[model samples]
Target: MLGRLNHVGVATPSIDDAVARYRDVLGATQIGEAFDLPAQGVRVCFVDTPNSQIELLEPLGPESPIAKFLEKNPLGGQHHVCFEVPDIHAAKAELEGKGVRILGEPRIGAHGTPVIFAHPRDMGGMLTEFMETPREGAH
Candidate 1:
């Protein structure tokens, strides 16, 4: 089962611009440095919030998934919502039993936790990510 709302993923044409909006306009003070996840084909930066976080995702390359999303809506928009889970494998099995389509095998996510994505069609047109919560004291 899901534990908490982990983060909301936002596809953006530029992470810098997104960060500027969150900081200058929204008055957000806790923002993480941008980093590349080449394997995931995205450059991400996190805007920390009281309850959850916002993940700004920019295309890392022409073939990146975000690139296609940006092409559809040049301004970019919400991509997915991630939820925390105590055990990712258990969650995957439970969702699979319910006939949900899992995007792929659980893999190391941006948070350094095991994570998996569920197909949007199975989730009310919203792509969902399930991330195992990191153990206390672990970065």
Candidate 2:
């Protein structure tokens, strides 16, 4: 049911510093950065690698999901695993139809792509994100 691992979400207090560290230490290059869906309260920076991507997530507010996660988890580390789907909206709907609770509705994610989150409880306590490249000519 899961698609390709799109990127690994890493919660960080300083996205620029994190991006620099990754670049200087691992030779990863920053691909892009964006702040989207203010309702979700996160600013993200994406770094490209040969096999995968590193997503640096910065919480926009204390009530943001990342903030809550940081309060209960480690200071900074992997947050969620994202799966690249052909159709995120459809996939989210399907999961909901099967009684899966969605964390948020579809919206433009930090990567400038359409994305949605599925509640961890529905997936064995693992937070999941479904993402898809916007269709051609789509905004």
Candidate 3:
């Protein structure tokens, strides 16, 4: 089962611009440095919030998934919401039993944790990600 809200993924044309807004306009100070996940085809940065995090996602290449999202919403918007899970495999099995369509196998996510995505249609038109939370100080 899901644990907590891990983060909200936002598709953006530029991470720099999103960081600027979070920093200057929202007064966020605990922003993490932007880094590229070439395997995932995304440039990512995390803005820490009290309860969760805001994941800024930008296309890493022309074939990046976020590129298609940006094309649909030129200004960008919420792409997905990640929820923490104690055991990813268990969660996957449970969801599978319920007939939910998973996007792919659990893989290493930007946070260096095991993560898997559920199809949007299966999740009420919203793509959902389940992340296995790392142990304390593991990250």
Candidate 4:
């Protein structure tokens, strides 16, 4: 099943603005640099916290999934919450056995580990992402 809360994905129209807010206003110090995740169609950055991290996602293009999300809320907002799993495959099977509808096949995530998303409906409105735990020294 789920291990610990990994990171919360926040969709933003601008990753730079989000990063500034988290750093200046929110007083977050361990912010990571923004980078392109072309495969996910997003420009991402991470703000590390004591317990978990905050992932800032900005659409890479008009057709990016986050762009559609931005259309609904121009300012952008919380998109999804990711939790770590010891074994993603087993967790997927367990969730599926309990009738949860996963969104797609397991794929490499921003953390460089396999990930899968459970449907929002099954997760009670908020999209849920499951990421396999990274090995030592890995993100």
Tens-digit lDDT string for candidate 4 (1-139): 5578999999999998998899899999999988999988999999999999999999999999999999998998999999999988999999999999998899999989999999999999999999999999986
- Mind giving the per-residue lDDT tens digits that candidate 3 earns over 1-139? 6588999999999999999999999999999999999988999999999989999999998899999999999899999999999988998999988999988899999889899999998999999999999889976
User: What tens digits encode model 2's per-residue C-alpha lDDT throughout 34-119?
Assistant: 45447678877778777778888888888787887777765678898898888887898888999999876798776568889888
User: Which is superior by TM-score, 2 or 4?
Assistant: 4
TM-score to native of every candidate shown: 0.97, 0.82, 0.98, 0.96
Clashing pairs in 3: none
Candidate ranking under lDDT, highest first, comes to 1, 4, 3, 2
TM-score of candidate 3 on Cα atoms, chains taken together: 0.98
Candidate 1 contains a number of clashing pairs equal to 0
The TM-score-based order of candidates, best leading, equals: 3, 1, 4, 2
Candidate 1 vs candidate 2: which has greater TM-score?
1
Steric clashes per prediction: 0, 0, 0, 0
RMSD of 1: 0.8
Off by over 4 Å in 3: none
- Model 2 segments more than 4 A misplaced: 34-37, 136-139
lDDT of each: 0.94, 0.79, 0.93, 0.94
Candidate 2 lands at a TM-score of 0.82
